[model samples]
Target: MAKYLVEASYLSKGINGLMKEGGTRRREAVDELFASLGGRVEAFYFVLGDRDVIVIGELPDNTSAAALALKVNASGVTTCKTTVLLTPQEIDNAVMKSGTYRPPGFDEPYEVENWEGEGGHLAED
Candidate 1:
């Protein structure tokens, strides 16, 4: 199982429906959805931001995550973004494996003074 960070923002229609049904109904709805995907929602929250809901869960795979996202998007009442989470050790291992690529472009030190003015380098043009 893999962990995912799922953020969702409800459309007006969905919010209205949720308001009508209340919290327990909302949890049940989410639980059913997760169960259908062979996953479990570890935590969920209603938040204020670009997204209305934040869900942390363990999912079977990327395909399962995409399927869940597609279903929510298809509902026409919410939009979602799913991020696959990685542990620090995973990142360290990735960094160890990234030695093949060579850096590109001018190797001179980047100029901080050149950026002091608004649209700085372009202004000289």
Candidate 2:
């Protein structure tokens, strides 16, 4: 299972619904939605500021997460931003792997005479 952090902002219609249905009802509805997708909600909170709600949960995979975002956004009630969560072990595993990558301008000639550009110069070994 993949964990996700979902931040949502409710639109006018969604706010109206929330006002009528209340917070617990909305959370229950969200829990039901996740269950239907074979996922589970770990935490849900109503917050202030830019986002109206925050949800932390685990879904089957990225596809399931995208599907949830698409369906909710399509409803015009709320807009969702989903972020995939990675554990510390996952980061450690990733760092253990090796890869060769050449950034742009890597092999290009640098005008040392006019090296007044940003980022300074590369040190010589």
Candidate 3:
């Protein structure tokens, strides 16, 4: 499963709704949303800032996360921003992967021309 950082900002109407239902109920509703999507809500917070809520959760994949965000956004109550979070191990693994990508109209791999390499000059230009 992939983790996500969900930043949600409630509109005026949503804030009024929250005032009526209360924070605990709002959090419970979020939990139910996550449960219905085959995921779990790790943390849900209502804070004072540009964003009203911050949620950390894990879903099966990016598609699942997007689906949840879109559904909530369509409701017109809150605007959500979903960010995919990567683990340290995932970053380490990615750093070790093969790199064969090249810029357009280029032949060899791209690298700093004047930057010194570990052992010394590593540029071919």
Candidate 4:
């Protein structure tokens, strides 16, 4: 399963619903929604900021995550931002792979190297 961080800001209608249904109900609703997609919520919180709610959860894959985001955005009650979370081991595995990319206006592709180094800073060439 892949993990995700979902930040949501409630619209006026959503806030009104929350006021009527209460926080617990809202969390339960989120649980149900995630269950329907074969995912589970790891954490849920309401905070004062640009976003009203934050959720950490896991889904089967990126497609499942995207589906959840699309459904929530379509509800018209809230806007959501979804981020794919990677583990330390995943990053290590990625760093071991080799790849190359050409910069804009450049003719040759530069070899990409593992950037991990002391103090977590990129290694000097």
Query: Candidate 4 lDDT, tens digit per residue, 8-118?
Result: 999999999999999999999999999999999999999998999999999999999999999999999999999999999999999898777665765666555434645
Q: Can you rank all candidates by lDDT, best first? A: 4, 3, 2, 1
lDDT for model 2? 0.88
Total clashes, candidate 1? 0
Total clashes, candidate 3?
0
Backbone clashes in model 4: 0
TM-score of each: 0.77, 0.85, 0.84, 0.86
Question: Would you list the C-alpha lDDT of every candidate in the order shown?
Answer: 0.81, 0.88, 0.89, 0.91
1-125 in candidate 2: lDDT tens per residue?
A: 99999999999999999999999999999898788888999999999999999999999999999999998899999999999999999999996876654436576443444344476654332
Candidate 3: residue 22 lDDT (0-100):
98
Give the per-residue lDDT of model 3 (tens digit) for 68-113: 9999999999999999999999999996876665666667666545
Model with the higher lDDT, candidate 3 or 4:
4
Off by over 4 Å in 4: 105-107, 112-125
Residue 65 lDDT (model 4): 95
Candidate order (TM-score): 4, 2, 3, 1
Q: What is the lDDT of candidate 4?
A: 0.91
